[model samples]
Structure formats: C-alpha cells, structure tokens
Target: MSKMLTYDACVERIEQLREKMIVTAAQKGMHDPLVLQYSQELDRAHNYILFLQSLNIDNLSKT
Candidate 1:
C-alpha cells in the first residue's frame, strides 16, 4: 500500500509551492497562467493540510 503523507509533509509542500509561486510570479508576471496554476496547486495543498488537521482532531476526540 502507498504511504500517506503526514501533516508536516503537507505543510512542507505548501512552503515549497509558496516559494515556487513567488519565483514564477516574479519571472512571468502575477497574471501569468503558470502562476495562476501554481496558486491553485497551493490552494489544494492548504486544503489538504486542513483535512489532515481535521483528521487529527477526530482521532484525538475518539481517544
């Protein structure tokens, strides 16, 4: 089975994407399509992080 990403990993992905998005925006302009794509990816990463946090909360409540 494939291993699931930990919360820390998701946060790390967000950080990486944030850096990349900034660099892309700087090089290609804020309105560039690639920059928009990176922003969308960042949004997905943030949402995943929230989902992970919710799972943790559920687990803690169950314990």
Candidate 2:
C-alpha cells in the first residue's frame, strides 16, 4: 500500500508550488491564467495539510 502523506510533506509541497508559481508568473506575467490555477492548486494542498494535522493519528496504530 502507498504510504500516507504527512502534514510536513504537504507543507513542503505547498512551499515548492509557491516558488514555482512565482517564477512562472515572473516569466509569463501576473495576469496569466496559469498563475491562478497554480494558486488554486496550492490552496488545495494547504487544505490537505490542515486535514492531516487535524487527524487523531494516535488511533491509527497497526494491529
């Protein structure tokens, strides 16, 4: 089975997305539609991080 994503990993992904989006916007202009798409993707990643952090991980121990 695939390993579950941790909150820290999600945060790192969000940071990476932000850096890439900035560089893309710089090259393509701020009004580019791709920038908005990237922003929405980042928001979704952030929400996933929050969801992971809110879970009661202690209850997920292996049998």
Candidate 3:
C-alpha cells in the first residue's frame, strides 16, 4: 500500500468514487449484478475511508 494521504484527500476521493458508482448504477439499472458489484466496491472504499478518518492511534504501537 502507499503512504497515508491526508484525510481530506481521502474523503474527496471517496466522494468522487461514490458519485461515479451512483451514476453508473443509475444508468445501468439496480437489477444489474455489475451495479451491485460496484456498490460492494463503494462499500469497501467507504470502509477504508472511515478507517482513515477514525483509526485508533494506540494500534500503531504494535510491532
């Protein structure tokens, strides 16, 4: 993985991904499996963004 970026940048990127996923889903229809796949991808990205924003500092001490 790459170095951690600023929270703001990660947020911006996550939002852009969300918008793209929404647009693609809307254009492709909700019933499409690909749309669902994109949604799962967005969920994963969202989770990563949340982790970036709210990670516990204490965990960093582990080696």
If both were scored by lDDT, which would come out higher, candidate 1 or candidate 3? Answer: 1
Candidate 3, residues 16-63, lDDT tens digits: the string is 767877887789877788777767766766777678655655457553
For model 2, the stretches where C-alpha displacement exceeds 4 angstroms are 1-4, 56-63
* RMSD, one per candidate, in order: 2.6, 4.5, 4.2
Candidate 2 lDDT tens digits, 1-63: 034567777778899989988998999998889898888889888778777765646456533
lDDT of all predictions: 0.87, 0.79, 0.70
Per-residue lDDT value at 25 in model 1: 93
What candidate 1 gets wrong by more than 4 Å, as runs, is 1-3
lDDT of 1 by residue, 1-63 (tens): 034678888788889989999999999999999999889988988888888899889999999
Better of 1 and 3 by TM-score: 1
Task: Provide the clashing-pair count of each candidate structure.
Answer: 0, 0, 0
- Model 1 poorest 10 in a row by lDDT: 1-10
**Stretches of candidate 3 above 4 Å error?**
1-5, 56-63
Report how far off residue 3 is in candidate 2 (Å). Answer: 9.3
